[model samples]
Target: MNMIDPWGSSIIDYDKLTEQFGIKPFTDVVDDIPHASKLMTRGIIFGQRDYNKITDALNNNKPFATMTGMMPSGKMHIGHKMVVDQLKWYQEKNADIYVSIADMEAYAARGISKEKSRELALNEYITNYIALGLDVTRDNFHLYLQSENDDVKNLAYIIGKKVTFNQMRSIYGFNNSTNIAHIYTPLLQVADILHPQLKKYGGPKPVIVPVGPDQDPHIRLTRDLASKFNEEYGFIEPSATFHRFMTGLTGEKMSSSKPKSAIYLTDSLKDAVKKVKSAKTGGRESLKEQKELGGMPDKCSIYELLVYHLIDDDKKLEEIRSKCLSGEILCGNCKGCASELITDMFEELDQKREEARKIANTLLK
Candidate 1:
């Protein structure tokens, strides 16, 4: 299987899938097939967690909790969808899921007005999540906002007492010039992880957190704090992870701050088309150049998008790659197809999201 780093450089070892801080894929997910091996490895890193914890929870028929949260920054983007997909996967695996619309974090981090944050958090953000097929009616999933609860505040206080300024600096790049306020951000995130059970349910079952790799530092810090809490309190299962990262339209980082860099779920079809059409391509500088030098399918942002989200069928992806390398496909036309597909996707998702809002309102209420 072909594996590439974030820079699009080839990765040599599949065993890196089972790192100390990552998920360990099952052998069946990795054996023989090269493409599946690559995805299995991706899934492991993306679903960052200890393999044993997952097995133990499932074996004991325990209702292990899984979590993923998003701050109400703006509309839900495709970058966010990647995490949502992982959450759906965990739900399929019978995880008692907890999703938080972190309005408090948004307030603390962005200093937005409470009304605006609430609008984005409740109507826009939470509505979009259910639109993306999150099944909250199962009763196992808990959907709540962080700002509404005092338990999280208490947990944040306890976690803050345990974590040192030095450790926060190391993880968050805080230094002498850094405000002490930024140092407390990690504790708030930790509170998000443990708040569900503290409020609604508590048990010894394992916990899993599904998030983008950018959130890895938070999980690592939470894991460390949870261990310390276990040693001190004699309870609480350390949260394991399922790690993953999404490729941007620029072949780099995906951020909502860079609107063109990500496809938001709320984007109009025209907006989706425009963004995809203007996306960075890994093709040659010009048609002449592309024809003479054949494009770098391996490094193209468009191709990576297909690999990451669009092309669900692995075999079809291989064919597209083969055609691209053989100069049988044009980058512009391929992107045009991708643009239409994404625009269509957003249209359908928007409809489902409207439906999900009604359901979420009734069920959550």
Candidate 2:
């Protein structure tokens, strides 16, 4: 099994993960999803757990909630944009949206102050979310900070009752050095994922959580614990969609703490282009060999940017992939294309981020 740690960095083996986690392939339902998002069409949104509930909600026009959160640790990169993209899709489907700002987790785990957490949550993260086309407008959306929401905190304390320290130790790989807050966080997330199903908010409807595969452990824990909630409070068991992690430009797991590994949405165009040019590629050592043997798009970070972020058109992505596989696209040329796309994207997002910051308060509950 790939070492998947929600708090730690890992380059996962998605195949082994799908099989082990019992996640159904997203392709199985692609034909049914109405105008499937680019990520789902591209298979980046790869796996699912009991997604029929979401499909039922979509098809039958039933009430379902889309729930996920950000921890406000730092500036969000394009990797974080994956979740925002899906959030927008679910929002368009009229699913009620709930976002949690994990100020408590950031403070407890990373020693980030509440002041800094609020800054990052609003200016850095939430503004970027608004910039990403998520309709954060009233009526449908709500945002809460973990440290601020008394109900969420109380729910966390209540849910903590069913989870054992030994269970936490095994699921999170918590050692003797792990603090109580760190142990409590998975339980906190369980509350975050399930709270939308509480009676006050329409009661026991299906909820969909879109997350990176690293967070699967929390989903599994939530699944088990939600049954306890169901028996008492009528909380619905949650369903989740998993996407692959975006490998860093330097060729590893993308991390917020490692600045060079990612291209922040707020980065200047020059810095973003520089990061792209420095990215790892699957090209041969020489132009001669690359032209003869072709490139490996699967291992190339720049190519992944085209597939996962930059190029939304399936036809355009396919053209790039075919050229790379057939030696027509050299690493230099491919990186240039990716850099151009990324630079243009950063310029647009920078403007939107500024605009988003202006009305971002309206988005928050």
Candidate 3:
């Protein structure tokens, strides 16, 4: 049995997740989407469940929504930017955007105080979200702290009525020793996902959650709960798109808690460039060996930085990949390019975050 701990930062085997967990490949429906994001086109979004609903809504110009949450336990990192990118794409499609700050979960799992969670959510997460061009001020964008949302809290209690402790244990690998708060927090997530379909928000419509593979357990539980309560709430089972986690600078899973493994959105431009330059690469041991065997872009963290964030044009991206694989571009050259790109990006973010901080301060009020 493959146990996926939502709170754990271990690496995930995405193939096993799809084959054993019934997540359909995103490529199966890629051509169906209109103006799919680069993440989708580049195959970063690997698996999905019921994404056809979203594609249908996109094609027909019907109402739909995109929902995602942030657990404000640490600084926001570059890996977290992928979620923002997906949300931005949904916004462009005119889908209602729901951003939930999971203060309750942060408290339950990480022992973070509600006040501290709120502070981090606004200053670290939301500020960087705006800096990344999420347009939080848009009329269709709904940002709320979970602890403050009475509707979500109330719905979570009601959701708990239908779920048993045994079910939670089975899905989350919970045991007798697990804290009750930690065990119950996932119900709040279900509420976060389904609350957008409430009558006050709008009648039931398609909703999509973009997440990493580790979050599949939540997606599965939410979908089941949505069906069990469908008669009362008219809930449409939420859809999800699972994206690959960004490779860390040291080639492990990128985690905010591991400062060396990730580049925080708030990092100084010099530090950001330094991290890129020092990142692991898939280069051969020597120039002579590299010329004979070629570089492996697939295993290079610096190459992943370009593919995932820096480069946008497919043709240009392909050229870089081809050069790397053909031994024409060495690790030093790739690192130089990645470092320049990250430096430019951080400089822009530095300016935008000042105004974003002001806007973020007012968002939760």
The best candidate by lDDT is 3
> By descending lDDT, how would the candidates be arranged?
3, 2, 1
Q: What is the TM-score of each candidate against the true structure?
A: 0.82, 0.96, 0.99
lDDT of 3 at 234: 95
lDDT of 2 by residue, 101-162 (tens): 88888887899988788888888888988888887775879898888887788888998998
Least accurate 10 contiguous residues by lDDT in model 1: 2-11
Model 1 over residues 94-193: C-alpha lDDT tens digits?
7888877666666666776566766776677667767878777787887776666577777899878888887776666666975555566668778878
Ranking 1 against 3 by lDDT, winner: 3
* Sliding window of 10 residues with minimal summed lDDT for model 3: 1-10
- In model 2, which regions exceed 4 Å deviation? 361-365
Give stretches of model 3 more than 4 Å off.
none
Ranking by TM-score: 3, 2, 1
lDDT over C-alpha atoms for residue 50 of model 3: 99
